[model samples]
Target: MHSDKAIITCAITGVLTDPGQHPVPVTPEELAREARRACDAGASVVHLHFRRQEPGKGHLPSWDPQLARDCVQALRAACPGLIINQSTGVVGPDCQGPIDCLRATRPEMAACNAGSLNYLKVRSDGAWAWPPTLFDNPPAKVKEFIDAMAETGTLPEFECFDLGIVRCVQMYRQTGMYQGLPEYNFVFGVASGMPADPDLLPILLRLKIPQAPWQATL
Candidate 1:
């Protein structure tokens, strides 16, 4: 049996959640409030995803560094010494926004999706959901993100969506593309990727290279 206590992380809000339609927080004040609640509830870390502040523009994500900075600062003030894990996932080629946010906030950790996967979904009728999308995370893009995070002394949480992507982390280490020990995130329960089952955890754990620490999130 595992003896060590698990670190709890609260994902306060996500990207592109309609602020009006849903209860997700949108403004800096709201974000900080939620972070405080998470900290009070024993969350050591808060995973952040900034949303657009403009009303009715809630469906889109924000890339403004100032906005990111404000949110991080607010959270820190609300919950002293709370660890922040910034989200750096972007769909298009330009990653400048995420890079800028990292520089601005200087969070303790940031997510670095090690590989790409099809951001897919389906309808109740077994039809395509909003068409298939290649959430591309090429080697070059990965390298760029790694370098940026390294500059700020921030830890990169490698989010692996599939087996092949999990193995690619090894390749990244071998090629000197990313330095230091690897931190893996096994993300499952998507329509196109791995399922959420405890039975599969052991097999997935076997695929990880030695000397690397890993965690799972459904």
Candidate 2:
């Protein structure tokens, strides 16, 4: 069993949650409030994903570095010593948004999905889920993210949704694409991806490269 004394991280907000529909905060003020709440609840870290502050775009993700900086500043002010973990997952070849955010915010940590996956879901009627999208994280894309994160001295929190992605981290390590100790976030429980069972934790742990620090976020 893992130690009970491990540090807890509260995910203050996500990228695509509609602020009007869910309790996820969107603005800097709301994010600061949630960060304070999490700290009071004994969380030592906060994972963040900014959303556009406009009305219709409130549900979509934001890649604006200024907005990201403002949100990080607000959270830091709220929780004087909380660790910040920024999200940097983006599709397509353009990584400038995420790169700019990292350079602007200079967060302590950030997420980098290790591999591509068909981010699919199925309806009750057996139809495609949400139009059958692809959360692409090709090797080249992964390298691009790593290079950017390295420039900011930020730790890459490898978000692996599948077992194959976990192995990809090892390959990245072998190629010297990612320096220092590799860290992983085993993101399970997605509808089409790996199941969220503690039973599989051991298997995932076994696949971890030697001397790497790893954790799970289910």
lDDT of 1: 0.87
Candidate 2's C-alpha runs over 4 A off are: 1-4
Cα lDDT tens digits for candidate 1, 1-218 = 97988888787776466777788887899999999888888999998998888878766778899999999989999999898988999987899999999999999999999998998889999889778989899999998889999999889999888888988998999999987788988988877888887888887788877768888877
TM-score of each: 0.95, 0.95
Candidate 2 local lDDT, 28-144, one digit each (tens): 999999999999999998999989998867778899999999999999899898999898878777889988999999999999989998888888998885787788988889998
